[model samples]
Target: MISFRPVDVDSDAEMEMLHRWVTHPKAAFWLMQDFDVEQVREEYRRISEHPHHEAFLGLVDGNPAFLAERYDPGHVELVGLYEPEDGDVGMHFLCAPTDTPVHGFTRTVITAVLAWIFADPDALRVVVEPDVRNTAVHALNAAVGFRVVGPIAKPEKQALLSVCTWHDFQSATSALPRLGASL
Candidate 1:
């Protein structure tokens, strides 16, 4: 089973791992290709300290397997860009880079991340604004029941604004294959 723990400034080693993952060519959409470990650490440290945002480390059998961030869309990522609902939460996730591929690993990771988000009792919907060019993530978002609202231009990049309600997620995943993970 997988679990999530809050990210904190003490996680230097995990920060290094994330630095590598985000800098990988496959992760170009992360937009941190040139970030060094210190830069990555400082960036996440800021997130960890922010009141409206949070970072989490996804653990698979106690080993860090991925990263997930959740934020108040009205306060942070989507502020002034989209009309955020009262319980809308913004999300970002990154699975660690690996040379060895596991069939359905990314899908499983995303499932875990979504389950984690929806677990919050106050959460009414999940919001995402992945880079417009990130087709892979677009498909993943759709599989998780996200419906594209439109494109929005942000300071960093053009992004596809998408949202998923709890009912939508339930409907989408109910018919799909189940992946095991507690998140």
Candidate 2:
């Protein structure tokens, strides 16, 4: 079984682990595949300091296995991309590269992410802007309730802007665990 818990991304040790995950080829969609350890550290450092953004390390039973980010779309990633709703939140996630891929691990990670985000009392909807080329993620986003609003050109890459309301997620994931369940 897989279990996920969130921890702050403040220590050098945590940054080091995240650097490896973000720079790996599997994280190319993350657009940090060319970054060195220090670059990764610096980038996340900025995120941590930003008032509207945050980064978290996801541990699978105490070992880092994924990264998740939450941000205010209105103030940060999508300032002009779309109209900002009162309770809209932006999100991004990356699964750490592994030699042995666990079946449903990625799905589990996404479900946990959505559940965690929606758990926030002020949050009413979640937004995502994954690279348009990332079809695998598109499918995963769909599975978790993200409804595409079509492609939009960002400074970095073409993104498929999508959103999911609380109802959308709840309706789409009716068969999944309620919350606080292990993967």
Candidate 3:
């Protein structure tokens, strides 16, 4: 089972683990490959301090497997980028790199994360602004119900803004296998 907990940036071991994952070549989209451990600590510390933002560590059957971030679009990431609506929340997730790849693992993780987010009564819709160049994530997001809202320019990179509502997610996952059903 996949579960989540608040990231404890104060823990050296956790920070080290996060550092290794973020610095890995596959994490280019994460934009922190050149950062040292302290830089990661500083960045996550900043996130931890933000009122509308929070980071979570994802665990699969008790071992760390991914990281997810949740933020209020109205108050943080999408502030001036676009108009924000009530109950709109922003999401970002990263799976740990592995030597053994599993088909549908990314799908399951994202489905789980979105489900987790929707569990919050206030979260009616999920938002994301991933880099346009990250085509893999675009496909993954589509499988989970996100609809492209067109491209938007950000200081860092051009991004594809997408949104997935509760209904959209439900419709998308209705025919899909869930976490415990052999996937």
Q: Write the per-residue lDDT of candidate 3 for residues 1-183, one digit (tens) a residue.
A: 788989999999999999999999989999999999999999999999999999999999989999999999888887799888899999999999998989988899899999999888899999999999999999999988999999998888899999999999999999986653111
Q: In model 3, which regions exceed 4 Å deviation?
A: 179-183
lDDT, candidate 1, at 154: 98
Query: lDDT for each of the candidates?
Result: 0.88, 0.85, 0.91
TM-score of each: 0.94, 0.92, 0.96
Pick out the ten consecutive residues of candidate 3 with the lowest summed lDDT.
174-183
State in Å the error of residue 171, model 1.
0.6
Clashing pairs in 3: none
Q: Per TM-score, what order, best first? A: 3, 1, 2
User: Between prediction 1 and prediction 2, which has the larger lDDT?
Assistant: 1
Where does candidate 2 have its weakest 10-residue lDDT segment?
Answer: 1-10
Model 2, which residues run further than 4 Å from truth?
1-10, 181-183
Worst 10 residues of 1 by lDDT: 174-183
Q: Candidate 1 — what's its lDDT?
A: 0.88
